[model samples]
Target chain A: MSVLEIKNISKSFGTLDVIKDISFSVEKGQVVSVIGPSGSGKSTLLRCATMLEKVDSGYIAYGDNIMVSNDAAGRAKYSDKATLNKIKLSTGLIFQNFNLFPHLSVLRNITEAPVCVLKKDKNEARQTALELLDKMGLSDKADSYPCQLSGGQQQRVSIARALALDPEILFFDEPTSALDPELTGEILKVIRTLAEDNMTMVIVTHEMAFARDVSDHVIFMDGGYIVEQGEPNEIINNPSSERMRTFLKRIIEK
Target chain B: MDYSELLKVTGILLQYLLPTLKIFGYTLAFSIPLGMVVAMLKMCRFKPVSWITNIYILIMRGTPLMLQIITIYYAIPMIQTGGSDFFGGLFSGFDTRSDTYQFTALLIAFVLNYAAYFAEIFRGGIEAIAKGQHEAAFTLGFTKTQTFFRIILPQVVKRVLPASSNEVITLVKDTSLANVIAYAEIFRKAKEQMVFYSSLAPLFIAGVFYFVMNAVLTVVFNFIEKKLDYYQ
Candidate 1:
């Protein structure tokens, strides 16, 4: 069963059409990687999927309900607050910058959503947050603030924060882009673990090798559209389009 | 120029010092929260609420504090009564010279003046937070109000404290402005003593009182800044 579906989605900022008629789908428990050159609208596509940016026109369905659709005037209809809240509850997004609340302790950062948004019992939220932290190997830093932790540790905390809500699908927007090479390993390792657990994930990433290693399928985007997509091996080893071959050659040369 | 006379004036000034400090305390207690409300209103996306709050802050910050005190103490009753016989009868026994009236007028003026300044400090702090913070909070399913109180307000308070402390210290000195309305604060009492004695000693004594009060406030605010040192 498809967990998410996007049909003919488009997004424009003022006069610029950042995303033009992008369509994609993710099946249950499948890890899909979106790879593209800089300025290809990969991140914007992810943001639009999560309703962080209003789409110019599209239909996005999560499960059986339509989350976004164009009205009679051809303007995308956003979900109301109640429906948006429900959509957000089921979809978690991890940002590249971590964006942890600096004033909150690590444990509080992880448990905040569960306690506040999910309305879980305090003790239950704490236990779940602790479990997530432990899974990320960050249990010892629970009492520390974001400033006290390394960038890698903070990113792990952000992932734990997202996971605490127990969303069915997670969106990672270049999760390791802001990390140092050594730090990137830690975050990628955590994500690799999630993939092993069959967690449904849609990742917009620059880590080509990690995508090739862990993703069930890979998508190559260029010029605001999908240039090529297939199984990881098929796309990496036997890309059919000359554009894909040139893009892959350029990435490999660098 | 006997030293003992100067000492007597200083002793008299001390008697009124506590009451002045009480006014400062009450003004701060009221204005901090009030300033946050004003800041929120100014930042609100709703045009009418933001416009009204902006006008209020502008008028309060633009006008003279002394005039505001005069208007509250003297002009309010005139406007209410419109110089009618009923007005005279209603307030005939009321005395503006009473301690209650004096303190109330001073308190009102101080709160209004400082609330404007504090509101600006709050706005600056809130604006300092990166746009990414709100985006992150929104993606996490936080409502606008929850995002503000939980994530944004704490960070704003942290950033605003230094500027806020500066305003607070200035407020301690601004309390002297209350003397313009005959509030009998420490400065008022000290000036009265100087008029009778025809000496600079009373003014010097008043200076000491302000210095001492400001010094104490500096220490308290420093302690507060230290508690917020987690970010540093």
Candidate 2:
């Protein structure tokens, strides 16, 4: 069964349609990478999928439940807070800016959601947070604040924070876009490990080589629509669309 | 003019200062939570609730606090019980023109006025937080209240501390305005000493007292700011 199904999803800000009739599905343990030029609405699509941006029309389903919709006025609304909470539990989001709570220590940052929101036992949340930090090779940095960590370390802690919630699918929005070239390896390594474990993920990324390497399915988007999609090898090796060819040529050359 | 007279005046001022400090303390004790409630009401998404709080804040902030004191002290009793006799009888036989009445009026006026200003400060602080933090908290499955208290309020307090400390210190000075109601606070005692002794020294001494109190408050606020230095 598909873990997430989005049908005819559309989003617009004022009158400018950022996403139009977008539809896709993710199976239980698939890694899908969305690649496109700037202004292609890839990030907006990811945000809409996560219910961060309300879609103007259509519906998002997780398992058998619809998570969002438009009312008579065409304003997007979630099904309900309770159902949104359940839907959010199944998905984790990794942001490009590494929006860690600066006031909290690394350990607290990871455990805050689990302890406060999930109502997990404090000791158990701390243990899980520490274990996730250890997985990110950041156990020693647990007591440090986000400001004390490098961009790579902070991003890794952000991932650990998401993982501490035990989400089934992770949505990464340009995870490496803000990293220095040298620092990108650490974050990519953690993502690569997750991909190897067959954790369902939908990633909007700019790293062409990383997309070509780790993605099971590659989606090319441009002008607020999916231009092309196929196996990573096919999309990278064969050009089906002239726009895709031009886009890939520019990325590959750069 | 002599040291003995100075001592007598200083001792008299000390007698009133304690009650003044008590009033200030009690007013703050009442106002902080009351202000927070007002701030919450002002921020409520519901239009009528927020609108009512907005008008309350506007009236409290827009009117002179001296008028509020007079209204609370004089007008409220006249309006409620029809005369000072009935109002005085209600207050354990204390006369409405007595020091106790003035003290109560001053306390209410200070609390209401500061509550309005603090509400505005709180509103600015709460609104200053990036919308992303709310989204982050929501996505983490935090309920709206949990997101506010755990994630949002702490950050808001950190941001508002400097401005709040300024207001708090200003509040200390503003307490001097209580003299209008005939409550014998520090400044009132100084004025009374001048009238009785024909000396300006007691007035200057009161300035010293205010300076010392504000200095102490400044130190306390600095310590608090230091504790919140995590963001830096």
Candidate 3:
């Protein structure tokens, strides 16, 4: 079963249509990577899927719970609060800059939402947070603030923060785009481990090799639309579209 | 320049310190929460609610605070004369000549005036938080209120401390503005002592009180700033 389903979604910012009637879904326990240039609206696509940006028109659902659907007027209408809250609980997002709460300890950064929003017991939340931190190789840094950690460690803690809520699906908007090449490897390795463990994810990323290696499916987007998508090996190695061919060549030469 | 006389004046001024402390303490206690409320109201998405709060902040910020004190003191009883039975009865029971009425008027004026200033400071602090923080909290299923109090407010308190400390120190000095309504705080006592002593020493002694209060405030704020230093 598809854990997330988005169909016929379009989004515009003022006069520019950032996402022009795009549609996609992430099946359960699958890793889907969205790879594209900066202006390709891949980030906007992730934003729309994660509900950070509203859709102009679309149908989005997690499992059987519909998050956004077209109303009678053919405009996008989101689900009621309870349904939205349910969808929110089932998903997590990691950002390019690792937007961790600097005011909180690394442990609190992971546990606060679960304790306060999920109403989880404090000790249980702490236990789950510590385990997630341990998995992220950040066990010793639990009491440290985000600012005190290296970029890779900060991103790891953010991942732990998302995982502590036990999201069925996670979204990454250029998770390693802000890190050094060396640091990028750590994040990619962590992501690869998540994929190996069968955690469903949709990552909007720029790292071509990492995308090909970690994703079960690769989506190449350009000019506000998905230009080509298929199995990573086929799509990355042999492209039928001229745009995809040059796009891959340009990335490779860089 | 009689040193002993200066000491005597300081002693006299010390006796009236309670009223000044009351003004400062009461204003801080009431205005801060009221300021947070006003800040929220001013930032409200509802057009009319925000519009009214904007006008309120404008009027409060635009006028002189001394004038506000005088206006509130005299204008309160005028509600009785507005000839609405319900409104008139609100102030009808209190003897307008009593010290309680004067103190109430002083508090009302101080609280409202400072609330407007604190509201602007808080608003700036709140707006300074990055958009990504809210997004992070939202994806975790935090309700808007939870996101604000838990995620946003703690960060805001850190950002606004320096600015808020400025307001708080100013509030300490501003308590003397109570004298405009004949509510005898330290500055008022100093002025009376100056006239009686026929000397400037009493007024200089009053300066010591303000200096000491602000010095203590500076230390407190620095300590708070340090406590929050665990985060960037």
Clashes of each: 0, 0, 0
Candidate 2 pairs with clashing backbones: none
The best candidate by TM-score is: 3
Tens-place lDDT per residue, model 1, B1-232, is 5989888887888889887888789999999989888988899999999999889899898998878887777864574467678766766554655668777767877887788889989999999998888988888888888998998999988899889989888888888888887777798898898889998889987998889878988999899889989874
Per-residue lDDT tens digits for candidate 3, residues A129-218, read 999988999889989989999999999999999998899999999999899989999999899989999999999988898889889999
Candidate numbers sorted by lDDT from highest down: 3, 1, 2
Clashing pairs in 3: none
Which stretches of candidate 3 lie above 4 Å from their native place?
B1-7, B82-94
lDDT of 2 by residue, B3-35 (tens): 999998888878878866877788788888888
Proportion of native contacts present in model 1? 0.66
**Top-DockQ structure, candidate number:** 3
TM-scores for all candidates? 0.92, 0.92, 0.96
Q: B1-232, model 3: which lDDT tens digit per residue? A: 4778778888889999999999899889999999999999999999999999999999999998999999989987888687589888887875787769998888888999999999999999999999999999889888889989988999999998999999999998888888888888899999998898898888888989999999999999999999998889
Give the lDDT of residue A226 in candidate 1.
89
User: Model 3 chain B — which ten-residue stretch has the worst lDDT?
Assistant: B90-99
lDDT of candidate 1?
0.87
DockQ pick, better of 1 and 3: 3
